[model samples]
Target chain A: MIFRIAWRNIWRNKIRSLVILLSVAIGLFAGIAVLALYKGMMNSRVRTVIYSETGHIQLHHKTFKNDYEARFVISNPEKLLQELRKNESVKQVATRTITQGMLATTTGSAGVQINGIDPAMENKVSGLLQKIRVGSGFEPGKKNQVLIGKKLADKMKLKPSSKLVLTFTDADGNIISAAFRVAAIYQSENTPMDERNVYVQQTELNPILNLGNGIHEIALILKQDTATHTVAKQLQQKYPDLLVEPWQNLSPETELMIDTVDITSYIIIGIILFALAFGIVNTMLMAILERTQEIGVMMALGMNRIRLFLLVFLETIFLTLIGTPIGLGIAWIVTSYYHRNGLNLESMGKEMMSNFGFSTLVYPEFPTEKLLGIMGIVLFTALASCIYPALKALRLRPIEALRK
Target chain B: MSTVIDAHNISKIYNKENIPVYAINNVHLHINQGEFTALVGPSGSGKTTLLNLIGGLDKPDEGKIEINGIDITAMSPNKLIDFRLRNIGFVFQSFNLIPVLTARENVEFIMQLQGINKTEREARIQTLFRQIGLEDKMDSRPSQLSGGQQQRVAVARALASKPQFVLADEPTANLDTASASNLLDIMALLNKEENITFIFSTHDARVIERARRVITLVDGRITSDTAKVDTHVQH
Candidate 1:
């Protein structure tokens, strides 16, 4: 009977009740959509770093990290590469000969990390060939050729087929200079990282530096991220002398960004829930005040204070329960549509996004695991909103209530 | 007959600034079992205040109220609620039936609070509905019923618990003459047949004329207490 009365009481003022429902629904929808957008943005950043810059795992000579000197080369590169290629978990692998060098033009010189890469194997691991914005990436018979970032080429006032001098220390610690032609200029999402690094053919650069078929780094892209730690562990056990690092260890900044974005989304939802609570409290208080006389009559007829409190509390819960599902449904529909078609923020400008290594078009992703938590927050808000009003109902003396 | 309600020097005061305004002043009253009593007074005469004190709904300024030998004035608020639920029934001026509930539900509400079984509750409600001539409107909500029918539902609810006494405040104020006369006949019949005491505060001549004992108040003080000649009781 109490429940029946509570339920009926919710519809006493249909417009008032519906307004509360709509507010809760809209609040939840906005919170869910914002959370999805943030998740998509973070996912894009992590994928960009994994596929373009770090790969899932990297193996390097332990001493090569101190300073990418040509002398600290991996002694058995072919053996490790052959074993890794046979593993089912490994998708693609490439070897690089890294050295600190300076690229100089007629205008000026700038410090850079010159990566000597196998053109065929580097394409499989780094997707470097696809990011080439201009000029054919490396020719089959090409010698003394390099690919430079668009930013670096612009800074140097150089173009494709432009001759540039590369100076670095050889394996024997001798200062060697080689002139290489820029075969292509590539533009990647990370403008800063692209500007700091340049790539060249291993066949041509290794002979000039007296590298003798040795490599500094062995990078592998796994089919799935779940295999990264396992593959890294296997490689570590096989080559104890080498430093095998997974993507998380190779780039801790990206991992931290992912975690930080998750926390930030929760905080955003909390702010929305906090705001919605006040509206619910206001609506319930009005309802309580309006029904003062009726409540007074109930109390006079022997309904106790606890029952009166429950009547108000139950009414508020019913109102919220009605609104929350509608809100979640609206959120799901909007997110799903955007997730497929993508939300284009290109109008916000390319330079703004590129500076932060972000994509202009984001495919929003819904985190279904968070649905339970969202429902709990709404339930808690409903209960919290009812406290002041329900307490007021409890405080009503029968005599006074009857008069009102 | 045993005294059902004993109010000694009951007084209630309202505050205006720092001054005290007496609503009920040093009023003494005793209502015995099976008596049909009416408390008649004009506006601001404190008839409702005295009734509230007797019903244990409000505290008296300088007195005590005893119902069936228990000093309800000394009871805790929670205990008073329970005492009222089990011992006293109240009918408000506005027919105060739960607007959302049906007539049967309104009557069954008190029995449910007392934890009565459904069979017993239904049987008792059926008998009371028949007695109040509202058996046909048992399933009708307060809004669906007429003002007089709604009042009858409130009366049936008051008597549903088989309380020792009923306190009605202006129960017939909103009813027509015919409805008021029909309601008085039912109360008089119930008073004689079941020996249940009934006390009412009203300005209606119809209710006053029907009461076997009429107590008149002026300026918060009882001026006259008269017992009329009645031919209904054959003892």
Candidate 2:
């Protein structure tokens, strides 16, 4: 009977109840939609970092990353490469002879990192072959062919088949210079990386630098991204002399961004629910005030304080339970639509996103795993919001309330 | 007749901290079982205050009240509420039926609070509705019913718990002349048929004329108490 009374009491003022219900539904929908957008953006950035910028795991000489000195080369590169290829976890592996040098053209000169890469192995490991925008990847059986980034080509006023000079120190500490023709111009999602990196065939560059069969870095992609940490740990234990690092260690900024996404999402939803709680409290207080006489009569007729409190508590719970599902349903439809069709932010934030190495066309990822936590937060908010109004109902003296 | 209510030198003071004014001052009274009594007085009299004190809705300031040998004034708030639930029923002046509930549900609410089973509650609801002559209006909400009908539902609710007594505070104050007389006839009939005790506080002469015993108050003190010999003949 108390349940029936509480349930029916909410509809006493239809407009007021519907207004509260709508407020709750709209607030939850906004919170969930924003959460999905943030999750999708972060997921995209993480994918770009792993697949395009750095492989899942990178093996380097202990001191090679400190400075790009050609003397710091890994010993027995072919033996380790063969072993990595046989490992079930490793999908693809590539060896790189890297150097930082100055590239000069007739129009301009700029400092850039030149990567010595085998065309076939590097293409499999980094997917660089897919990023070509202007010309074909490498000419078959051609010497002195290089792949330059679109940003670098634009800045140096160089085009496909253009000739450029690279000057750097050799392994014996002597100055070395070579000329190479640009085979293609490629563009990546990251602006700074595109502006700073250029690639050349390892066979041509290794001989020019007087470093025969020397490898400075060995990078490998894993069959599954979730196996990155395990494979890196196993490889590090086997090769204690080399520096084995995972993608997270290779790029700390991306790791930090991924770590903060959860906290940032929670804070955003917390602020929204806090504001909605105030609205709930106000609505419940008005309901109680309007029924002062009825509550008084109930108290007089032997309804205890606990029953009165439960009545008000149940009414608030019903309102939240009804409103939340509607909100979640709407959020699911909106997020699923955007997740499938993609939300294009090219006109609004293309430049900014690209600067941060993110794509403008975002596919929002719904937080399916976090739905339980979201509901727990909403229930707690409803419970906390009902306390004040229920206490007000409990404090009413039957004689005084009846008089009112 | 055995005494069911005993109030001794009870007082209720208002604004006790600054300037104390008495609402019920030094009032002593007794009521017996199966008696239809009325507390009649003008404005500013303590009729309503005395009714509230006897109904266990308010505590007296200076003295004690005992109903059926239980010291209600000495009981805790929770215990007093339980005692009221089991021992007394209430009817208000404005027909304070729960607006959201139908007439049948309002009558059944008290029995539910008392933990009565469905079979007993259904049976009592039928009998009470039949006695009040509103059998057809059982499913009607308080808003849908007329003023007289709502009052009759309130009366049925008061008696549904099978309480020792029913305390009615100005029960007919808002009713029209015809409705008031109709309600009086129902109350008188229920009193005689079931032998249920009834006490009312009112300024209405119609209610006072029908009551078997009349106690009048002025300035928070009793001025007169009278019992009529020909009450049945007058009805």
Candidate 3:
């Protein structure tokens, strides 16, 4: 009956109920937007790393990952390729040889890092072919053809079919030079990556390294959520002096940074929930003040302090139960839409997002648990806010309350 | 029947900053079982204050109050409210009904507070409405009813708990003369029929003329205690 009365009290003043409910809705909306943006930024980074920098995993000589100076060339490239193909765990493996040196043209030349790859294998490993919007994918074994990162191409004022010179430096510090055609211009998600990197055929690089059939690394594409620990163990045991790195290990700093962002978003949610709790407290205080006389009458009519306490507490709960769901629903819709379409944050504010290593485009990624936990906190804080009002109602003396 | 209220040297003082105002000076009063007495005084003669002290709504600055022999002034805040809910009912000058509650529900509120069985509460409220000539007005809100009707609803609410004493703080002040007389007669009739104690703090001559006993006050002091002519009681 007290519950029934509390519910009806809201209807007694429709305008007041609506006003309080609006505050709840706005508070919830702000919290939801913060969460969505945070998750979206994380998702965009994952996409960029997967689609551009590295495949899901990379295979390198044990010392190469540490030194990263081209010391991990595959000793028996064919055997490793055969073994990798036979195992379903390895989705795709593309071999690449990297050497850094200086290059020049009639206009200007700058120092750059050159990567030699089989175009077909490169497409399977890095999805580079899919991102080639303006030109065609790189061709395998082309003697003088190469793909230059868009940033490099822009600096050189070069276009498709433009002539470029690639120079490879061997581990012994021997420099070998070759002329190549610009097969395509590849765009990198990050400007730093885009401004560097020259790609050519593995055959073109084989002679430069002087290892007849040597390759520095094999970029491997694997299914999402695979058992990376087991796969790394197997690959390491099969090929001595070689190591396999999953996405998480390959980008530990990035992962840690993303986790930090997640925690920060939750902290933001806590602050918003506190603000929301205070709003409800203010509303409840006003409600009690308005009904002072009625409260006194109830007290004189033998209503115990506990009953009045329960009345105010129950009223806050009722309002929250009805109002919180509205904002949650809106958040769910907006997040779902962004998750599907993938937000274009780059389009919205490109410079700001890129400053944090984020692309202009973002996708809302809200997990069920994250959504549920945020809602629970909102609800708990709202209920907690009611305690003061309930206590006040209980502490009221019929005499002092009725005096005015 | 037993005495419903025993007030001892009840003094209520008000303070605005350091200045002190005595709302109820040291006074002692008693209301016996099923007695209808009026406490008549000017607006600030401390009549309402004294009534509140007796109703267990306010604590005396220097005295103790007992309702149904229970020392409510000495009781915890929780217990005092419980005693009020079970033992007293109030009708205020403004007909202080819960605006959200319908006429019948407002009357049923005290019983609801008792946590009484729903079937019994419904029956009691039904009977109350039938007596108050508001059987058709049960579901109507306080605003839907006339001033007299609203006060009658307040009257029904006070009586529904079947309390030993029902306190009225000028319950008829807002009603028309005819409505006031009718309300007074209904209250008087209830006093005779149920032997329920009805106490009023009022200046209305109509109520004083019909009250079984009138206790008049001037500037917080009892001036006249009179016995008025009795009117015929209704069945």
State which candidate has the highest lDDT.
2
**TM-score, cand. 2 vs. native:** 0.91
What is the full ranking by DockQ, best candidate first?
A: 2, 1, 3
Please tell me the TM-score of chain A for candidate 3.
0.86
Docking class of 3: medium
Single out the weakest 10-residue window by summed lDDT for candidate 1 chain B.
B226-235
Model 1: which residue pairs collide? none
- Winner on TM-score (1 vs 3): 1
Clashes of 2: 0
In order, what DockQ does each candidate have?
A: 0.73, 0.81, 0.66
> Pick by DockQ: which candidate is best?
2
Task: Say which candidate scores most in TM-score.
Answer: 1
Q: Where does candidate 3 chain B have its weakest 10-residue lDDT segment? A: B226-235
TM-scores for candidates 1 onward, in order: 0.93, 0.91, 0.86
Candidate 2 Cα errors over 4 Å, as ranges: A104-110, A172-175, A209-211, B16-19, B229-235
| A333-387 per-residue lDDT for model 3 (tens digits) | 8888988887776556765565455777677765455877777777787679889
- Residues B166-204 of candidate 1: C-alpha lDDT, one tens digit per residue: 999998999999888888888889889989899999999
TM-score of chain A of each: 0.94, 0.94, 0.86
Clashing pairs in 3: A301-B85, A302-B84, A302-B85, A345-A360, A346-A360, A346-A361, A399-B57
- Evaluated on CA atoms against the true complex, candidate 3 attains a DockQ of 0.66
